[model samples]
Target: MSENIALAGADLRAAMRICMQGKFPGVQLYAHDGLTRDGKPTAVAARAACKEEADGRKLQGPERIAALTACFNGKRPDLAQRSECRKEARAKGLDGADLRKAVDACAREARG
Candidate 1:
């Protein structure tokens, strides 16, 4: 694992949040030209992601997050993305079960 990749929850979130909120300064999203399958630049996907994040923040507790983490193995999210997730975990104090979940998630993705 690269030292840049935080294998833990809180640490990873801190790095990631920094990147997402533009704190890192030069990072850019290489998304699909902000377009959808319908050839529309509506940014619906971006809006939905933001909405989902807001909604997820409402669900308190690590167990709740753990359940969500258990289902989605995004197949080894890149170091940058993992950093963002770690940043989010830090803000939310997701250091317990969430940390375990993050480790398990990394392992699962690596295995695949």
Candidate 2:
């Protein structure tokens, strides 16, 4: 039973290696079965860029996490900034092509 379990583990690792290679293409597999080429357990590194703002205020706790998740899912947090640009243009009585040009300028300035 121990030998069968060991074989199954090896099979799983081999399958993982093949799948990783096919998907990643150029990424080198640094470890197999948790040990590195130097026979050390792979160290996992994690980072959180959870600083998100809404209406010029920083989000906290669950709100921050939710915003981070939204960012991870490809949602742009700068959408509010764009909306603000549109509002500013309208307040200045801009319309038609003039409003579009002003909004574009505001968007560019916001990005900078």
Candidate 3:
């Protein structure tokens, strides 16, 4: 049986908010799932900007991880590293709940 690792939804949301706030004041977030109208990630430039914001936050440990996951949720090809990081987390049996917590932490840190 495959072990289920949960990611923290709150953390993920927080991280995403932090990452997005830093870059965009009211930009909408979207999930790509490796598919788009052209079979590729859309809004590449916007996604790239968001990634830059996340990277600039300098989130460490789980917080960093959560930020990356949020980036993937947006399907930003510019954030190739984040996408890979998400894959690695899944491979290591990391859960979404845990990731969410990390994201939340990042958001709090960024806001403060």
Sorted on TM-score, best first, the list reads 2, 3, 1
List candidate 2 stretches off by more than 4 Å. 1-74
lDDT of each: 0.53, 0.65, 0.61
lDDT (10s digit) by residue, model 3, range 34-55: 2454555555544665578777
- TM-score for all models, in order of appearance: 0.22, 0.34, 0.26
Residues 1-112 of candidate 2 have per-residue lDDT tens digits of 3554444576887887898999999876886555466554443211132232332357777876776556533433355567789999999999999999998899999899
After superposing candidate 1 on the true structure, give the runs of residues whose Cα lies further than 4 Å from its correct spot: 1-77, 102-112
Q: Go through the candidates in order and give the clash count of each.
A: 10, 0, 20
TM-score quality measure for candidate 3: 0.26
Q: Judge candidate 3 against the unseen true structure and give its global Cα lDDT, from 0 to 1.
A: 0.61
Best by lDDT: 2
Best by TM-score: 2
For residue 58, what is the lDDT in candidate 2?
74
Residue 38 displacement in candidate 2 (angstroms):
37
Candidate 2's C-alpha lDDT? 0.65
Worst 10 residues of 1 by lDDT: 71-80
